[model samples]
Target: MVVPAQGLPASVRIHEVGARDGLQNEKAVVPTEIKAEFIHRLAEAGLTTIEATSFVHPKWVPQLADAERLFPLLDDIEGVALPVLVPNERGLDRALALGADRIAVFASATESFAKANLNRTVDESLGMFAPVVARAKEQRVHVRGYLSMCFGDPWEGAVPVHQVVRVAKSLMDLGCDELSLGDTIGVATPAHVRSLLAALNEEGVPTSAIGVHFHDTYGQALANTLAALQHGVTTVDASAGGLGGCPYAKSATGNLATEDLVWMLQGLGIDTGVDLGRLTATSVWLAERLGRPSPSRTVRALSPDSHKE
Candidate 1:
């Protein structure tokens, strides 16, 4: 018997960051089990790539102090590739010790953001990535790169497209599997997204190697994502329940909401392989756990209906 054939799926790779980058700065520390389960639930929902935890120092980000505790519990979850952030040699040693399957390193596009956010110059930060990427490659672990302030910087205002392209190309050359372009301050417009992507494309960075991380401060995240998608950005970084903010940015809100992004994709005839009802429920669940209103409009719209069923 032959199964019915369908048209090409509207493919998109969404990188869920709620557990690490999303909840890094939460005032109340989420339990290690809850964080782990939240991650498990997302993987069960068809997210292939999830940022599970970070190995930064406990004194630096107290909320994620449990990376060691939470990381090991996630063993043997099929179909999901868990990657944790490693800021330096110390962090890398810890993750490698834990047998991390993948790792990510970051650098800022602006000099001020580089120093203030990571306490290093752009050159120094990129320099650090060299060894880390090399070590991860030795261990057969996938390495990813993050270029923060790719769209706009809080301290420096508008970031140059040249800066973004240079950093992205440099990271790709450093042996990164992919690069996530972060709008740390939520100040990027559609025009900004387009211009940056155009510059990268001109520089010969394959569209497949780029990802977008947007914040919703001015409600431009979704719009910017649309612009990015139009320009061939197939990978996106979003947080469940809109769960994160940039600790380095004074007034930025959460990253782009997963439910909202999924909604937009569904409406535009894209296949995300996500259960909207479940995703929305999880968003609301996390928001309620945090004692805050949800940052996702799709979650609000769908949660009650899912419960009615």
Candidate 2:
């Protein structure tokens, strides 16, 4: 039943964000123990790059306030990469103190978002991240730059491709090892996705160094992801069970579901090293803890209760 795709990569590296981005927006803080177990289960389910937590201030995202406590519990997990989000130098310091070698800095593609999210102008925020990226690179830490609102901004409406390219190039110039283009409000269509990738290529940003992080706000996450894959982007940012939405962008919804992405990749005969059944089960287990059904269609379809009625 597998249909091979002509242009897609043979294998995709899924950057699982369930632990950090997924739980950060939750009104109810998931306990440190549960968060640790969630990450452990994700590793067991074959997610090699799991974003463990953020080192942002507790006042900003209280849900992940237990990052200090949660990260230590994941020390015994081997073979999987645990990347953390560092908002500033202090955040980076905290993550480094906990032995985190991989970190991501979130950036905005539009001025509206930059002001709303970081309380600074786009250039100012980049200036803030300059030293952080420089410091991380000094220690040989892998740094990923997350460019949000690449396709469209809630306040700015349609984002110019050139504007995105400028910021993306800036991040790479800051010595980020990789860049994850985020459709923060999920307004990206397939053509928009392709155009942006092509534009980045024109600006000397290779497709191999870019990753795609799409939201399902318009139900275009999968479609957009397909466009990125066809462009030779191998890294994908997905949340297990579709568990995350932007806390800053009110219009943004849950991220592309890992289960949904896995199903599509499996059908396309792409190797992701993920066990779909185990991944679905872990999402189901976490849904129970969150006291709601998983928003992911693939998870809901394969879940045990789906067959009950």
Candidate 3:
């Protein structure tokens, strides 16, 4: 559907990141069966675009070392887009071998973040993705590019808007079907989100091909997401139970909560197709597995015990 003149789309698509982005940084080693169950439950809660896992090296992200084992189990799940993160050509090879049709690659918008996360400079990281993107297209796999630290960086302070637009265009040129702009450090305000989206639009990046991923470091995730929605960002990334932070960026914190985002969107009369009560229950259940109370206010507010069912 076309974005209205106010720039908000009638419906929004949520990219659920709980399985991959959410769990990757968790200290506890979540078992393979549990991870698979998490993904299934997310789909059952009406999330169609759930990011399942990553193929990054075990030494780097031990939490997701079970990607190879996890992918096959999820192969039969229908209607949902189960995209996994592939850090390089090797990861892509593993994913393609398993007949994984959807994959995501991450690139940093700042040099310090690139070095810390991928051990490469920004240009070098893009160079690595060129071949990976090419190979994925050759294999008819869908590719989503993740541009991290788009709003600000820990070491570098505020990131220039132009830097994000440049990297975003490069990823699109390399054949990414969409780009998820990340506020890795979660320092972005609504104004910052608007300016960035405007810059990207000026550079000819269609709003339809862009998504926003925010963290609630300053409790601004939902507000920033609302700003993006007003600017026509249809796809927003959120994690169940508000579970995620960038391990490479210490200042980063929990992602925007899926239940919280759903609550806001549904109240705004935006269709997300998610069952709020079921999604909240899923987060509560997953939080139990993680041995902690969920960080999501919506989940806590809607939970049966907290408020009368």
Best model per TM-score: 2
* Candidate 1 least-lDDT 10 residues: 1-10
Task: Name the regions of candidate 2 deviating beyond 4 angstroms.
Answer: 304-309
List CA RMSD, all candidates: 3.9, 1.1, 2.8
Off by over 4 Å in 3: 1-7, 304-309
Candidates 2 and 3 compared by lDDT, better number: 2
Query: Which pairs clash in the backbone of model 2?
Result: none
Could you tell which candidate, 1 or 3, scores higher by lDDT? 3
Our model 2 lands, by Cα RMSD against the true structure, at 1.1
Q: Compose the digit string of candidate 1's lDDT tens values, residues 1-309.
A: 223223323668889998888899798999998888888888877788889998889988899899889988999688888999999888999999998979999888999889987888898899988989988898888888998988777788888899888888998888999889999988899988888888888998887888999999999999999888888788999998788887777777898989899888877778788887777767777777777777677776776543332
List, residue by residue over 138-217, the lDDT tens digit for candidate 2.
Answer: 99999999999999999989999999999999999999999999999999999999999999999999999999999999
In candidate 3, what residue range of length 10 has the lowest lDDT sum? 1-10
State the C-alpha lDDT per candidate.
0.85, 0.95, 0.91
| Tens digit per residue, CA lDDT, model 3, 95-192 | 88888899999999999999999999999999999999999998889999999999999999999999899999999999999999999989999999
Pairs clashing in candidate 1? none
Q: What's the TM-score of every candidate structure?
A: 0.93, 0.98, 0.96
